[model samples]
Target: MPKTKKLPLNSLEWHQHPKLTTLLSGDCHQLSTLPDLQFISFAQLQSILDSCPIPVVKRAKVDAYYLLAPMPILKQLLGHPDSHKLTASLNIYSEPEPTLSTLALIKPALFYQKYKRLPEILHSRLDKAKSMNLVTPNKNQISQLAQISPSAFRKITHSQGGSHG
Candidate 1:
């Protein structure tokens, strides 16, 4: 076995995909050597970062740390039809409920605009909203209040480009 030398924190390099930029930590280098960019999508990496404990983050930052991702990615993620659901299936995980919740709070109306089926979007996440201790209209309630039929609602939603994903 051979011994390997560990670089000090500030000497460490962060690599980011050329496609995405981090919202808060926008300094990730575009170097080609780091392995993360090869194996992880920006979305997956972000979800992991969001789920990491605080101490681990501090230690990583001690190096010339950089995290890459863009707000639009965040927006698109927060914009998923199932964004509010945090459960994992087959080793894949949805965005954390809190992460989606925070993005929603930052721009409460963005989700509505992005998905184009504001009512249905709200409807799907009704339970999630309640679980997170947030207020939201019940399923089908928004449709009733709007006096739109499911068919008409579908048309309207589709007209607006319904689902982004």
Candidate 2:
């Protein structure tokens, strides 16, 4: 009797895709039946990602506003030579919208893709302050109004020295 030869491992492209990673990580129960995760190349991986719902939305909404980041951090990234040309339009503060300043929200995926640094979102922190109802110049007021922290707010101001330009 002839012995059977072992099959080579599936393609390596599966792990390279962020969308794929998010999907597989998100719903393992659905993928339990998958025999193997071999994709041929980046293009193939991209094709699969394109077909998926979450990845599709994620890629499409890379430019879409998902939530707000503090203004100072936005300004800091906008002013930096390395990051400036990548994105603009951070000047999203409304003068009539009360005391706390804020930039238009950006998705975490967009931030990671652009800057390679995961920006800290202050929503949770702000929420904490609000739950406590601590009314301080720094904490409760800004958190309640803008849902962002003073430190995150200061990042942009620190970069621009309070100049919104």
Candidate 3:
């Protein structure tokens, strides 16, 4: 599992939405936890997550944890339509929502046609870290070593002509 912290099981995006009105009008929550959640007992879990307009809603007993799958639907909702941006968002999150192949279709529209946007996102990340003085390069030795570390990803993708930027 990726490293992640537990929040209140509330939405990370609580202010705006998938529209609570529509969600509430329906009797059930359109989503549940990931399939892995099936391993946990959702017998006591509500079929849906409740919604309210109040800024502060009391923390209800959470029987199951729901994650917004970082899929095409969410990408479109976030106004980032490029697959590279979508993929990047998925990769960089502290807890990237799980992706499902069947239902996770990206819409026809895209924010960008090419992933030229990838470098920009990466640059911004580095810039933020630099601004915070979080980067200290080892100029002489360790920094001189190959940029890509040996591991499952490197070994698999290296022969295919992929290089770490």
Per-prediction TM-score to the true structure, in the order listed: 0.20, 0.15, 0.19
Best-fitting candidate, scored by lDDT? 1
* Tens-digit per-residue lDDT, 47-158, candidate 1: 6435531111112344432222222232333334434442211111132333433433554455556655654554445545788987545445444534455433332345
Q: What local distance difference test score does each model get?
A: 0.37, 0.29, 0.28
Candidate 3 weakest lDDT stretch, 10 residues: 44-53
What lDDT tens digits, residue by residue, belong to model 3 across residues 1-165?
333333322223332113323333444434432221222122212211111111222122332222322222332223322222221111112322232211133421243333333443344444555689875332222112212222211122234333324
Model 1 ranges off by over 4 Å: 1-115, 150-165
Ranking by TM-score: 1, 3, 2
Clashing pairs in 2: 11-38, 67-105, 68-105, 72-155, 72-156, 73-156
Candidate 2 per-residue C-alpha lDDT over 1-165 given as tens digits, one digit per residue, 9 for 90 to 100: 112221111210111123233333543342122122221233433343333212111112323321122222332222233331231222222231221111122343444443331122243444456689954234444443343444554222244232121
C-alpha-based local distance difference test score of model 2: 0.29
What shift in Å separates residue 129 of candidate 1 from its native position after superposition? Answer: 1.0
